[model samples]
Target: MSALYRQARPTTFDEMVGQEHVKEVLLSAIRTGRLAQAYLFSGPRGVGKTSSARLIAQAVNCTAQADKPCGVCAGCRLVREGNHPDVLEIDAASNNSVEDVRELRERILLAPLLGSRKVVILDEAHMMSKSAFNALLKTLEEPPEHVIFIFATTEPERMPPTILSRTQHFRFRRLSEGEIVQKLSRILQTMNREAEPAALQLVARMADGAMRDAESLLDRLLALEVPITLAQAEAALGLPPQEALWGLAEALEQGQIRQALADAQNLYAQGFAARTLAQGLLEAFRAGLYAKMGLGAGPRLESSEEKLVAAMTALDESLERLLKRSDALALELALLAAFQALHGSAASPQAAVPGKPSLPEFNPVRRQPPGAKHPLPEAPPQGTSTPTPTQGPGSRPQMAMDLTQAWRNVLGVLKINQRAFFREAAPHLEGQKLVLVFPEKASFHYQSALKNLEAIQTAVREVMGELEVSLVLQGEKKKVESRSATSLREGSRNGPTPLRGEASAPAAVAGLTSTGSVSASSPPEQSAQSAPPSSPIAEPRVAPLDEPPAIAAKTAESALSSPPLPGDEPPWPDDEIPEESTEAPSSRAQTLVDDPRFQKLLRTFGGRLRKLVQDTPKAPDAEGAAQGDEGSDE
Candidate 1:
């Protein structure tokens, strides 16, 4: 009388409809006298776990039947009445402390007063604390004779491994829709009540495989009306009409946006919660999707196979993305997105069912014929342009000089493996070109960059609008090889020279200027002995071009003695000839005369220089003095 679920709860294994597997196991154990000291019953809620535990207790202590529970016996009747002295039931949720477990341990050790054996049932056993579980562990492993412990929990994962190892685990399953409907029908017959078949089916489906929830729903319906119908059940439960949900599915399949929105608004107008509507739509679509994939269609799906597949696939995808938000706006948006995706021309097969290749991806939305243009206005031609004031050079629109920002943006969109390669590349902007340069040695990276050129461009466009770009390897474009003069000679002697190769004149001059002393072929001892004591090569010397002959000679000696300026480029374009010995000034002059670069320098200034052997710098000085004396006398 308290409620249909409590009043009609099964008292024996035979009366329980679902969980046949568990019933068979418990029956076999009782028949064989293989009863374990501790047993764990685990599964989803409202699936007869507590009822099964009670039945087991009654079966073991009943005075009548040896194999099963004698429901009419004094022991079974006392168990059913919840007044059995020998059998104990504990709600572990509220009393799960170590003290409670210890008290139970003290009581469990006592002999049965009114039954053959003492039995204990602990419901929600997973709620017990670690210490409490440890306290119960020893009793569970080796209990006194004629004492039994049965543990029931919806969550077995929370139980300790030691507890599980000491007991036998039996799993209870949720009742199916058919099983729930059968149980509800049996209850209705017992109460001599009449209800529509559709109402019972709706209650079962809404129960979500829980028999107690279905019974509770049925009790609510019974309180509303003695004889219930589908309409009254729907009204009492606040469920939207199945007809309306079916209509919404039809609207989606037909690509009727106005109808879909109007149907949803109407459902809300009829007092259905937004969340309930979303769940209903999800179920309907889920059933259709299953049917499309050759899975069995559920209780009610009115739509045809062809249209159902498309509509359900679209709605299913949209709901997954938006169902977490159970508000009206979220539900509306989900419906709209699904509709548009199913009805739009650009929607691809992959977009329809992402990550599923077996489901053919075809555009469900109707499209216009090719070359059919709309009446909208077209843009003006490129020649008809408008001019604006020019931006300053520094402020000009171009890719950034340091492409760290752009590269990061680009890498964000690329796949993981591609990002590693692109990270090593350096980006620079030169005029209209966005150049990505890699080291010459990493040819693979250069090739990969080229391979993913389109993806790179797409990312760049996303980040920096539109721009032209180029790929470059560091030393690819400029055909310059940096080889030392010695290396050049070695390569020439060891291998064939490449086509169009030129030994740079500047490089040769730089080499000669760097190696200012005697050539590498000269012996160190002989080279040291060849230098004269006053050769000016050892002592510092300077050459002053504007001074008199004697003074200029001394300055030149000082200038020549100092080491050649480090890395100074020679004015001429070839190597200088080396002297056999720096013993005499004439010998040095002769060496300079024989050098091709020095001869070229002289030829370049031939018209400006004059040489007279007899009339030297002294003669010019004497003439200038005579002229000055004449002027003074006058």
Candidate 2:
């Protein structure tokens, strides 16, 4: 007439399936007569919390023996039949109001009707209202000597602290699968029914550690009135067969995605839901993992632990999706995505075949060894006008090499900014002198190269060994040379160059001459014999050409009176004029001031020529310089 779980409810502490710790403590307290005024039982569902509470009530009122609630005693029978006058069982879930608790408190004060003590059990005690708990708190803390109170709940944390602190707390635990299976077997034996071991195990797993749930599931299977089999159990529960799940897990382990998908689709077609299939496969993989660890019995799979774990992870990720949308196509798509995550998609071209040779992996960047040189571009062929160095007498004899290669090596060794300027120039080595010739229009490049001559010369010496370096315009070399000779002749006839700050008239003095020669205020001497050549002369600083004569004179006078700053060049002598200049103007500072491009820059910018400051070489390590250059280029 009643549910199977109620028919099989535990009647005594010894009859309970698990929670031996709770049973041992309660039994000792009952036998020693050290009973507390109130008791609290807390644990998960269907694991003997209510059963234990009832057992305690019957034990305290039992009259026959100290073994407590002997099944043959009148008090135990009345408690089991739910008609004991002194034992009261209240469902706190439905009667959790303050008025109900006030009535309970008034009833607890009355004497026992049929037994020596009155026991009150409040099941689901955590459902009681806060006010109800407060009303019951004083009585629970100090109750009548002839009465006892019991509170049972699944979540003790929800109960008020005052109520919890006034009771003797006992915690019940969920029974393991083995204990549940054994208990189910005993129950089936009592009913005179037979069940396969696999069927019992499946029922226990589905119960998820709750004895009542397991009993109910077993009772459903027994309604057929036939011996229970694995197939019948699975079909009744709407679960895929264990063999099908194992087959899918095997396919996944062996990287057979097609076969795995086929197996999943077959299960789905057989009326099994997606969530059911996913859960079954997950259990199968978990059993495999356990078997791999030698922990318990499971499907004896050949999959390694890592493969089983990976398969389990895939199943777990797909299980969430199956929960949201449980359909045939969704399950298939989930399986496919999981397969691709583990083993790449079937349509991927990169997958390896069994017999054919696999394609070699190609990396676009080739790593070079440390300190190895990057291969230079090939040298131009002969008669290609690539510059070649000429060995001359009284000069350092160098190895015969391609001048183009030598120039490239020098460019590579220079700093990034210097290389940007010098790369536009074509190199021509004449004897020991290396001339960098720029196009007539590339005056900026030519001027920049001249400013960075020291860095270029240092790099050249590293590559070609101490060659004199010169920069020249491609078509104006001859004109530059002739102009330098004429300037030297006029300078010999005149006196020495004036100081930069002097207020002398614009003149073709020995050193202060520019490209456009201004007329001299002093008449030139008729002496034909030239003065002997002196040491190399410094280049003159000329004023801007567009300025008025008065303003130019004033600027010169101000410059003459101002003190020279640190590192400033000393003024030239007033009487000693050089006669014959050895170095050509194109190779020295004079060439830069005399070039039309340089004059144009001066006129456009409207500024006098300041002192020329050459950069002194700092780093002697050529490799370090090359590395620094490459870093700047990047």
> What is every candidate's alpha-carbon RMSD to the true fold?
16.5, 22.5
lDDT of 1: 0.68
lDDT of 1 by residue, 1-634 (tens): 4777888878777898888888898899999998888899999888888899888888987889889997889999889878999889999999999999999989988889988788899999999999999988888878998898899999999999999998999988878998999999999898889998889988998898888899899999988646898888988998887767767866776777789888998887777877677767767666556766678653344445544555556666666655566666877876876666556565455675543112111112345644347644454545764543432344334324225555677789888877776776787765445678888877789888888888788877776556666888776744444445554654333222211222222222222222223324455455333322221112212112233444333322332333334443454544544436656755665555565665444322211111111112222443453333233223
Worst 10 residues of 1 by lDDT: 606-615
lDDT agreement with native, every candidate: 0.68, 0.71
Q: Report the error of model 2 at residue 252, Å.
A: 2.3
Worst 10 residues of 2 by lDDT: 607-616
Model 2, span 1-634: residue lDDT tens: 9999988988787788989998888898888998888889998888888888888878977878876678668888888889998898999999999999889988988999888889999999999999899888888878999988889999999989898778889888888999999999999889999999999999999998899899999989988778999999998877888988878877876778889888888888888889888888889878877877888666766754544566577778888887789998888876766565456533333443332221111112345645357864554555655433433332223422356667778898998988999988998766668888999888889999889999999988887776789999875886788998887775444324332322222332222322222333433231111212331433333334443444334433443344454644333334643345578644544544454443433332211222221111222443443333333223
Off by over 4 Å in 2: 293-301, 344-634
Scored against the true structure, residue 167 in model 2 reaches a CA lDDT of 88
Q: Estimate each model's TM-score.
A: 0.56, 0.54
* Candidate closest to the true structure, highest lDDT: 2
